[model samples]
Target: MTALQAATRETFWTIGPVGKAAFYWLAAVAVLAFGYGVYARFAAYARGREDPRDRLSNLPGRVVSATRTVLSNENQFDGDLYAGVMHTFVLWGFLVLLVATTILGIDIDVYRPLAGESFWVGDFYLVYQFAVDAFGLLFVVGVGMAMFRRYRERDGRLWGKHTSLEDDAFVWTLFLLGVGGFVLQAIGIVGQPARADEAVSFVGMAMAAGFEAAGLTTAGAEAIYGVVWWSHSLLAFAFIAWIPYAKPFHMISSFANVVARDETAGARLPNVPADLDHTNAESLDDFTWKELMDGDACTKCGRCTDACPADTVGRNLDPRDVILDLKAYRESVVDDPVAGRRDSGVATDGGVDGSATVSDGGTVPIVADEGGVIASESMESCMSCMACMDACPVDIEHLTSFTRMNRQLVDEGAVDSNLQDVFQDVMTKGNTFGESQSKRGDWADDLEFEVDDARETEVEYLWYVGDYPSFDDRNKKVARSLARLFEEADVEFGILFDDEKNDGNDVRRIGEEFLYLELAGHHVETFADCEFETIVCTDPHSYNTMRNEYPEVDFAEFADDPMMPFDREEPWNADGETDVLHWTQVVEELVDDGRLGLSGNELDYTVTYHDPCHLGRYNDEYEAPRELIRATGADLHEMPRSRSDSFCCGGGGGGLWAEHDEEVKPSEERLREALEDTDAGDGIEKFVVACPMCTTMFEDGRKTGGFEEDVEIVDVAELLIEAMEAGS
Candidate 1:
C-alpha cells in the first residue's frame, strides 16, 4: 500500500479486521437500543397532561441559555463546593472526551476515506492525543471522587431510599470506560513498532512504561491491547444504551428540563379550573408533562433537600423524595393503569409490599398510605420558601410539584386544622389572622399624615399593607414606619384601607388555588375603582403575588366577568398599566434620588439582614433591602446563608400559624446561626428584615430560642425610621 494509504488506515493499530467488524456491529446495536430507550422515555412523558413548556418562538435563545448553563457550570457551584468540584471535573472530562471522539470519527470516516490521509496526523495529532489522555485521567479522577462519596462518605443526599444499584452502575460504567480507554491506548502504543514517541500522550506513556518494565513482550501487549480496546468500546456502548433506563436518565432529561424551564423563576401555582372537579393533581395524569419530566430530570444531587427548611427542621417533607416518588408513580402507571391506582375498599397493604393486586397486575398503591404520593404531614410542612427550587442544579421546580400536590390535598379536604382555619379566615374575613376587614386600616389611624383611602382619591401609589402589618401589633409598628417614610418622601400613595383583601400569595402556595384566585380577583377589582399608577406592598409575599400572580388572576377572572376594571388586554406593566413595587425597592429608589434622607451611625448599631423567601428568591430583590439598610447608616453584617441561599425564617407558606412539635424550629435554627459571631467587635446586635412574615417569625424565634438578650429582630423600615429620627 502507498504511504498515504497506510496513513489513512483505520485509527486502531492492533485491532484485526474481525475485531473492527465486531466493534462496528456492537456500536450499531447500541445506537439502536439507545434510540428505543429514548423513544420509551418520551412515550412515558407523553402519558402526562399537556404543558405549554416549550418556547418555540425563542428556540435559539433557549438553546443559548441552556448551553451557557451547562458549559459555565454555574448552577452546580451555587451550592456545595466539594460536590461542585467533583461535578465540574466529571462534566468537563466527558465533554472533552465526547468532542475528541466525534473529531476522531470524522477523521476516520470522512477525511481519511476521501483524501487517502488522516487530517489529524502531525503536531495537531500529538496535541489531540495529549488532550484526550489528560481528559481521560480527569474522568477517572472524578469517578474516583464519586466512588469515594458513594462508598466512604456515603452522603445521605446521594444514597438513600430513592437510590438503587443503577446509580452505582452508572458511575462505575464511566470509571471503567475512562480507565479502559487509557490502558488500551497505553498497550497499543507500546505494541506498535512505529509509535516510538510516547510523551504526546503523557498519561498513556506512563502506563506503557510500567507495562514495559513488567517485562511484557510486544506480542503480549498487542494481545492485551486488542482485548482491552474492545472491552472499553463495549462498555461505552452499554453506557449509551443504559442512559435512558437508569438514574443517569438525567443525562438526557436535564437539558430538556433546563430549556423548557418556566419563564418565571418564582414558584407559580398551576391555574386550576374554576370548576371544583380536577382542581389539583390527583394522579400522574393530572400533572403537566413538564412536571412529569421533572422527575426524569432530577440528578439526585440532594441540594434541594439540603436547602429545604422543612427538611432542616426534621419535618416529614423531603423535596427530593417528593420528585422521586412522583417520578416512580408516573413510571409505574405508564404501562399499567392499575399499577398506580388506589381503589376504594379494594384491600391494600398500604404500600408496595404484598400480592394485593386488584386483578389488573398492580402491587403498589398510587396514593400509598402516606396520603397520596406524599404524606399529609410532608405536604403541610412546606414553607414555599423556593430554597429547594433555587438550589436545584437541573432546574427542578419542586415548588410547582408541591403546590400541585397541595391543590389535590386541599380539594380533598385533607388539610391540617390550622390550615383549615386559615382558609376559612381568608375566605370569610379577607385576612389570614381572622381580623375584621375594617381593622386593616386601623394601623394607619395613628399616623399624623392623612392616609388617603384609594377608593375615594386618585393616587400614584396604592400602598398595600398586607395581613401582618395591618393586624399584628408588632408589625403594625412596621406599617406606621413605612407610612412615615412614604410621607417623608412626598410620595402620592393611598391605601385601599377596609376594602383590601389578602394578596393570597401563601394561600396559593398552601394549595387553596380557588380561594387565592378569588382573593386576587377581589384585589384586582379593588384596583379598578382606585386610580393608581403603582401598587407598593409592605409585605414581600404580597409584593410577589401582586406583581407576578395577580395579573394572571385578573386575566383569568376577567373572562368570566367582563366588567373588571384593570385592562386585561394590556401587558403586565405596559403603558397605562400599574407597576408593582416592593416597599424596600421603592424606599431604596427614594434614598438614591435624594428624596428620602436618613442619618446613620454605622458604629452605633451593626446589623444583619435576613432575606425573606418571597423577596429574595421569588422576586430576586436581594440587593434593594441591603441597599436600604446600608443607607440607614448601619454597618451591615451578613449571615453565612444570605441572599439566594438564605434560610427560611419558618413563617412562610402559612407556617407561622401552624404548630410544630420539634424542639428547635427552622426559625430558631436561623436565629442561632445569626448569633454565631455576636461576641466579635463588629457583631450583629440587631436582625433586620424586610418582609412582615420574616419580622414576625424572627421576633418569635428571638423569644423562643432565648436570643432576645443578644440580638433584637426589627423590620428594615423600623431601623430606617430610627435612623431618620436620630438624624432629625
Candidate 2:
C-alpha cells in the first residue's frame, strides 16, 4: 500500500468504533446538561420574579463599558494584579475551551475539516491539549492566590472582615474540582496505548505512567478512564447546580447586571413619582415589582461600603450588609408572606432556640440577636451618604430600600422612641430641628438682596434653599454668600422664601421614603403654580431631589413648563437658557463671563477640599467647586480619596441627628485625612467644603481633633464670594 493510504487508514483506525461510541455518549451528556441548565436558570429567574430576558436593550454599549472597566485600573487597587491576571486568564481560557467543547460535541472533526487535507490533526490536537493544560495550571494557581489572600494575608482595609469557614471551603472545593477535571482528562488520554504518538499530551502521558506503575492492566486502564470521565462530568454538573446558592452565582448574574448597569453613577437618587394622581397607586405600600427587585440585584462587592463615611469611621452599618439584609428580608417574605405582615401579629420562632420573642408591633430592638442578623442599629448605622448606591455595580437603590423598610417599622410603632421623636420633628417642623415652619426663611432676612418669593411671580431660577442652609447658623453664611454671588453674576434667580418646603432627599435617604415622597410632592405642588425656567440650589441633596425625585408627583399637567431647556433648542440659544447650577459653579461661570472678579490675595495657605458625598460623588460636581477654590489662588491639596472615591462627612443619611459611638465617628476620620493632606510646617489655615453637612462635620471634627484655633473650616461659596469682594 502507498504511504499516504496507509497514513489515512491509521488516522481512521484511531477514531474507530469505541472512540465513536464514547464521542456519542459525551454528546448526549452535553445536550442533557445544557437542557437542564436552561431549565434550572429559568426556574431561578421565575422564583426571583425577574425577567429572563435583558431589560436593558443596549447590549453592545454595555459590553463596551464592561470591557473598559475590566481593562482600566482606575477603581481597582494596585495589589490586585495577581488576582486580576489569574481571573483574566481563567475567563479567556474558559471561553476558548467552551468553543472547543462545542465543536467536539457536534462530532465535527475541527482539526481535520477546518485545517484542510494537508493540515496535521495531531498538531491541532496538541494545541487544544496544551491550552487546556495551561489553563488548568492557571486556574489552580489563581484559586490558590485568592485563597491565600482571603486567609493568610491580614489586609484589613482592602479585604475588610475575614471570610467565613464555609466560604473558604467552597473556594477550595471549586479549585479542587477544576484541578481534578483536567487531571482526569489528561490521564484518560494517556491511558490509551495506541495513542502513544500524541506527544503533545505530556501531562497526560505522565499521569498514565503513574497509573500503569500502580498495577493497572489494559482493562483496568479502560475502567479507570470511564470512571475519571464520569467523575469529571459529574463535577461539572454539580458546579452548575450549586451556582445559585453560592457567590459564584455572579457568573450568570454579573453579565446581566453589567448590561443593566445605570448610565448615571446613581450619585443622584431617583425621584419618587410626583404625579401620583396619574397612577392607580394610592399609598407608599403600592411599590411596583421593579421597585421591589431593586435590592435583590446587589452583588455585595463592598464598593459602597468602602466609600461610605459611616463605614470608614467604624459605624456598624456596612452598605453591602444593609443591601444583603434587605435582600434576605425580601427572600424571607417570599418564603413566608406572613413574616412581614404587622397585622397578623403571629410570632414565628424567631429562627432561634428560646430567644426573646419579637412582636410584630411595639419597639424593635437596636441590637441583633446571637446570630447577628436583624437589628435597628444596622438600619441606623447608615448615614444616607448615598456612597453605597453610587459605588454599587448593580444599581441597587440601597438607601431607598432601607428608608422604605425603616418607614414601615416606624409607622407600625416598631422603631425606637428617640427615632419616633425625630420622625415627628421631620413631619411637623419641615426640618429635623423641630423648629416651626415659619422659621424656614429666617436666613434670607439677613441678606441685603430682596429674596423673591417665586410662588407669585415668574422667575428665571427657583432657588431651593434646603433646611440646613436656611436654619443652621453656620450654614446661614453659605445661604447669604450664594445670594450675593447670584447678585454679582446678574443672574435672574429667586428663592421660594418661606414657601420653600423640604425636598426630602435627606429624609428619603435616611429611610423615611414616605415622608420624602410627601415632602417632595408638596414642593412640586408649590412650584406648579410658579413659572420658572430653571431650578437651582446650593444644596446637592435638594438639587438631586428637585431634578430627579420631584417628577414622581402625580400631577402631570399642572407644571407644563419644560424642566430644563435643551441647549440645542432655539430659545435656549437666543435667551441663554437657565440651567441648574451650584453656587460655586455659578460663581465660577460669572468669573468666566467677566461678571465676577477675584481679588489678588496672597492666600498662601494650602487647602484641601472635602467632597460632599452628594455633591462630589453623586452629582459629579467636584470640578466646579475645586475650580472656584483654585480661583482664590490657594494651593489646592487633593485628598487621597477625592472625586468619585471621596469619603463621606459622617453627617448624611440623617446621621446629623442620630447618635454614634465615639470610636466610630466618621467626621474625625475625614478630618484626619484632610489634616494629613495639609501637613505642611505652616499647617492648613482653611479646610474648604461645599456641602453644608460637610461644613458642619469638618467644623465639629476640627474641634474634636483639637485644631479649632489652628485650622478653620469654611465653605467654597464663602471663599469665592470673599475672594471676589477682596478683588472688588
Candidate 3:
C-alpha cells in the first residue's frame, strides 16, 4: 500500500476499538432497558388476572378497525380530535426515538468492528443522526403543545383540574433530557470534523460549523458528548422502570386494550349469557372470572358519562366511574383471591375484607373504604340505558356487568321492595302487569280479520305483539293500525296472541339478566315449537334480544336453532319480507305497494318527528318512518339532536317503571328540544313517535312541562293509517 493509504488505515485502526467498546456498552444497557419494560408489562397483565382468551379473540380485527377509525374523517368528535392529535404526535415521536436509540446502541456496540472501515457504516451513521434530530424536535414540540393544552384550553379547565404539577414536571424533564442528548451529540460531531466529501450526518454537519466557530477544542467537545450520552441513557432506563407506576403507563396499556377490544358497532347491545338459571340462581353467586374480565376492558373515555341523561341531570351515577369500579374490583380479586372466594370471611393481605356486608342476593354493599373498591350507590345509580356501552370506543359491555350485579341483588331478594314486586309480577304472570295469559288477546277484539295462530301454524310473518301493544289501552291502537296495514297489503301474517310470552328486553337492560334469560329461553322455545319463518316485533328491545342476545346461550345443541340463526345475514321476514317494518315501515310499505294511499289534503297541520333511541340508533331505521310522514305531505320539522344523536325519551331500560326523582327529566329535556323545533318557523304542532316508550315518555313530559295545551303527540303509524283512510 502507498504511504498515504497506509497512514489512513492506521488512523482508522486507532479509533476502531474505542468506538467498538462504546457501542457494546450501549447495547448492553438497551437490552436491559427493553427487558425491564417487557417484564413490567407482563407483570401488569398478571396483576389484572384477566382471561387470556378474551384478550386474544377478535384482537387483530379491533386493532385494524381502531386504526381505520382514527385515520378516517367520518363523524369526528372535536374534543377527541384535540386530544388525539396531541397524543398521536407524542406517540409517534416516542416510537421513532425508541427505534433510533436501539439502532444507535447496536451500531456503537455490535457493529463497531466494521465501523470507519465500511462505506455502509458512514451511510447508516448519517441516517441515525438525522432520525434522532428530527424525532427529538417533534417530541419537544408535541410535549409543548400538550402542556399548553392542559394549562390553557378553556374546555380542559372547565372539565375540572388539568394536569397535575408532578405530571407537568415529568414531561418537561423528559423534553430537556432529549434535547440535551441531541445537543451534546451535535457538539461532539463539530469537534471531530469529517471530510466534506464523506457522507455527513445533516444535524452533525450543521453543529460542526457552530462548534468550530465557538472555538471548542476536540477534548472539551468529547467530554460534553460523554456527559450528554450518559444522561440520555440513564433517563431512558428510568422511563422504562417508571412506566408501570405512572400515568404514562397508559401509553402501552391503551394500545394493548384497544387491540383486544370487541368489534361490534357501538349501538348494538352485548349478548346476555344464558348459562346461569334465572329461575333458580338467587344471587350473583354464579358469576365467573370471564364475567369479571368483561369489565376490565374499559378505556375510561367518559363518553358514557357524557351521554348519560342521569349524569346530565345531576344524578349520582357516572357510567365511566362504574366501569372503573369493575376494573378496580377485578384487580382487587387478583391481588386477593380470598376476597372473591365465597367461603372466605376474613380480610386478605390485599386489604379486601371477606366479611363485608353481602346481601342474600349476592350484592357486596361495602362502604368505600381503603380495602373496598366499589360502593353500593355506584352500582345502584346506573339507569341501565346502555349509553355507556354505546359511548365506549372499545365496545366494553358495561351494561352486562351492571346486569350481572343487579341479578345478584334481585335473585337474592336484596334489592328495594318496589323492584321485588316488579320481579314477582314478571315471575308469576310472564309479564310485568301480573295479568293472566288469556287477557293478552283482548286487544285483538272487534278487529275485522282472523287472528291466525303464531305458534301452531306457518305464516310469512309472526307479529310479536309485545306486552305494551297487547295490554296498554293507548298502544292497542298502534297494534290495530299495524294489523290493518298488513291486511291491506295482503301480507300473510299471524299473531302469537295469548301464547306469546314477554320478551323481557327491558328486564335485561335494567340489569335483570337472570330474569331476562328465563324469559328469552321460553320465547326461544315457543318460536322453535311454532316453527315460524320470521318473527316481527314492534318493540326494539324484543328485536335486539332475539337477534343479538339469544345467540350467546351456552347450549351447543341450540346454537343453530331456527329461531336464532347463526348468520344474522338472513332476512327476518317471509319470502317477500322486503322490510321488517316498524309499524311505520308497514304503513310505508302499504303506501309504496299502492295498497294504501294518503290524501294530501287530509292533514293540514305541520308535524315534527322525534327519533326514538332504539329505532334510530339501535336499528338504524330512521328513514322509513320519516318517509311515511312525508308521504302524507305534512310539514316535517326536525329537532336539533335527531337521528343517531337523538336524546333518550327517559323511558328506556325500565325507566318507565322506576320513578325518577325529577331534577331535570330526560323526557322534558327532549320535549323542550322538540318544542323549540316546532317554533322554528315550520309551524309544526304535532310530534310523531315510532316507539311506545318514546310515546309514553313524551306524554308524561307534555303533562309535566305544560305543553299539552299547545302541542300534541301521535304515533307515526297512526298518521299513515289516517292518511290512508283519508284517501279511501
Candidate 4:
C-alpha cells in the first residue's frame, strides 16, 4: 500500500490544521505551569530542618519499592476493596493515556516527518485506538464513582466538614476532564466522513448514536465537535497545570514519600539527636525535611483517622487532621528559613521571640497546640498503638511529629498530673507504679519449682517480667501461671530478682528517650553480669522494644557485651545471636515440641484471642498465641478485627497510666466488640489476651462493661496453665 494510503487507512484526529496547532500551544503552557508548581512545592520542602534521611543509600531497592507501590496500589485495596479498585483504575488509566499521548506525539512529530507517514496504522493502530478509548471510558467511570462517593452518596470516610476546597476542585477537575474527553470522542465519531469504518470504539459509537438519535445533523455534529474538542483539550491542559496546586499533588508526592519511607519496623521511633532537656521541633524549621514532605504526600484519605483508636473512641486526636494542619502551618509560614532572622529582631542564635520561638532554645512548642497543628490534649489521647501507621497508604508517620512534640512537652514540664506521676515513678522506682524493686519476683513464689536468679546461676532463658506482670495483682497471676508452664516444660529460665527493672518500652513511647536510654543502659549493665542464652518476656511491648528497638542502642562498650552461645547475625533462632521471645512464643514452642503436654487436656470454653498492638502489628506475632490456644484444646473463635487489624485494648503507649474519659475509652470500645456476636454469629465466652497490658485493660474493661457474668478475660498463659494442671 502507498505511504499516504497507509497513514489515511486508519482514522486520526479530524481537528484540522489550525485546531491541532492551538492544542499544542495549550499543552506547552500547561507543561510550564506544572513545572512551576512542582518547583515551588519542592522548594518549600527544602526549607525544612536537616534530617539524615536524604542519603538515598539503597537507591535500587527504593526504586523497586516505589515502582511496586505505584503499580500495585495494594495497600489501599487491602483496606477497602471499593476504594482500591476505583483508585487503581484511575491511576492505571491515567498512566496508559500518558503512554498513548507520548506515542501520538512521536507519531506526529518524528515518525510522520521521517517516513512521510505515521508509525501507528492498520491492526496496530486499531488496537491502540481501542485500548486508549476503552481506558478513557474506564477512567470516566472511576471518576464518576469517586464523584458520587465524594458529593452525592457522601461516604463518611471521604467527606467531612474538614474536607478542603482544593480537594473538591481536584476531583471535579478530573471528572470534568474525563467526561469532556468521552463527549469529544463521540462528537468526532459522528462528524467524520468515514463514520461507519471509524466507529471501532464501541463506547464512542454508542455515545454518537445517542447524539444522532436526538435529531443531530452532520453540520450540527461538526460544529459541536470543534467546540467539544477545544473544551476537552483546554480542560486536559488546565488539569495538568492545576495538579501540583490541588490535592492531586499526592500523585507526585506519595511516590516520593514511599521511596523515602523509613525501612525500620512501624513502631520504631527515631532517636532524638539533641539533648532532651534542650531542644525538639518547635516550628516548621525544627521538623525534618522528610517529615515536612509527608504533609504534601497526604491524600486526606482519612484511613489513618478512621483506624486511630483515639479518634475512634471520641478523642480529639485525628491523624489526618494533625498532618493536614501541620502542612497548612508550614505553608502559612515564610518559605525561607532565615529570611527575616535579623529583621524580625529574632536572634540568629535561635532563641525565643514573640509568638514564634526558635527551636534551639526549646521555648517554642513543637507542633504547637495553640498553632492548631496538634492539640496537646490530642497528643495525650494517643495510645501509640500503631493503627494509624498501619492504615496509612502514603506512609505518613503521624506519631513522629506527635512524639517529637510530646518530647518538647515533657521537656517543658507541661505533662498531665497522671503522666507526671508515672514518669516520676519510672525514674524513682524503675516501674510505672512506683512499687518496690524487691517485690518484682513475688509473683512466682507459689510455683513448685524454683526460678534461678540469673545473677547467681547460668540459665537458658532470662525472663524479663515487665512492669504489669511483675506488679499488678491480676497480671501477677498470669506471671505465676507462666512460671508453672516453664517448670512443666522443664525450661531453665530465671529472673533477675531485684536487679531487673522496667525495660523502658512504654517509657520510650511516652517520648522520654533519654530516660529510656538510661534504663536500657542499666539493663545492659545487668545483662553483662548475668549468664543467659535467651531473653523471654511476658509483655509484647517489652518483647518488641528489646527485639527491635534495643539493637539500635550500643552495648559494645558495656563490659565487652557478655559473650553469648548464639550469633547476632542469625537473630532469634534456636542458636541465633540474641533471642527474645514473648511468653506466648515460648509456650507455643513448648507445646509444639510435646514438652508442655497439652494433648491430654480438653479446654471446653469457646474462646477468642485479642491481639496486642505490639505483638500483631509491631512484631507480626499473631499466630503463636492462637496456636497455643488451639493446643489447649479450646474451640477457638476469632474476632472480626483480629491479627494486624486488631483493636487496641487502650493500654499501650502509657495508656495504662494515662487517665481517659470513661465514656469513650478504647478498652471499653474493644470490650464491646468482644461482647458482640462473632464473625460466625456465636458469642465468645472468654477473651484470651497475650500481652500483660491487654490483660490489665480488658480486666478493667470487664468491670466497666456491665456484662452479666457472660464473658471472662484471661491471659493465654493462664489458660495454658489451667489445661496443663487439668491434664496432669
**Model 3 off-target regions past 4 Å?**
1-79, 102-142, 153-230, 265-300, 329-337, 347-372, 446-451, 555-595, 598-610, 616-622, 634-642, 676-684, 709-711, 725-728
What are the models' TM-scores?
A: 0.93, 0.77, 0.76, 0.91
Q: Model 1, 1-728: lDDT tens per residue?
A: 63322332236767778877888898889989989999999787776777634434587898899989987788887866777777888988998999999999898889979999777866667778878988878888988998888888666778667877888888888888888888887787778756656466888889888989998778998777766777778789988888888877787899888888885745445566545345356556677778888999998878899888888888877888878877765665566655544333243333332112333454333332352456667777889998988999989888877787777778778777898999999878989889888888999889897899889999988899888999999999999999999899999989988888888888888888777766766677677778888889999888888788765543543445444333443324423267888988888988888776664453368778888888888888899988888887788878888898999999887798798666589878887887784343237788888888888888888888888788888888888788888877
Error of 1 at 515 (Å): 0.8
Best by TM-score: 1
Indicate the worst ten consecutive residues by lDDT in candidate 3. 4-13
TM-score for candidate 1, residues paired by index: 0.93
lDDT of each: 0.78, 0.60, 0.60, 0.76
Q: Which ten residues in a row have the lowest lDDT in candidate 1?
A: 348-357
Let me know the TM-score candidate 3 reaches against the reference structure: 0.76
Cα displacement (Å) at residue 330, model 1: 2.2
Tell me how many residue pairs clash in candidate 2. 19
Winning candidate number (lDDT)? 1
Provide the RMSD of all predictions against the true structure, rounded to 1 decimal: 3.2, 6.9, 7.0, 4.7
User: How should the candidates be ordered by lDDT, best one leading?
Assistant: 1, 4, 2, 3
Q: Tens digits of per-residue lDDT for model 4 on 1-728?
A: 74323432323355787876787788899999999999988887777667644536688899898889878988888669988888888988788888988887888889889999766876667677788888887888888777877786666767554586888788888888777767777777777656546545778778888988987767788777666767777888888898888787899999988888875534667666533234665555667778888888988888988898887888767777777766655554454454322233333222111223234322223344453345677778888888888888888877777787777777767777888888888888988879999888888887777789999999999999988888999988988888888888889989998887888888777778767766776776677788988899888988887887776654333323343211133112223376888888877878989998779346887888889999988888888998988888888878778787888999877788888764566777777777674763336778889988888888787777675376888888889888877787
The local lDDT score (0 to 100) that residue 181 gets in candidate 3 is 60
Candidate 2 residues lying further than 4 Å off, grouped into runs, are 1-83, 108-138, 154-166, 181-231, 262-304, 325-345, 351-373, 393-395, 415-426, 436-439, 444-449, 452-459, 556-578, 599-602, 677-682
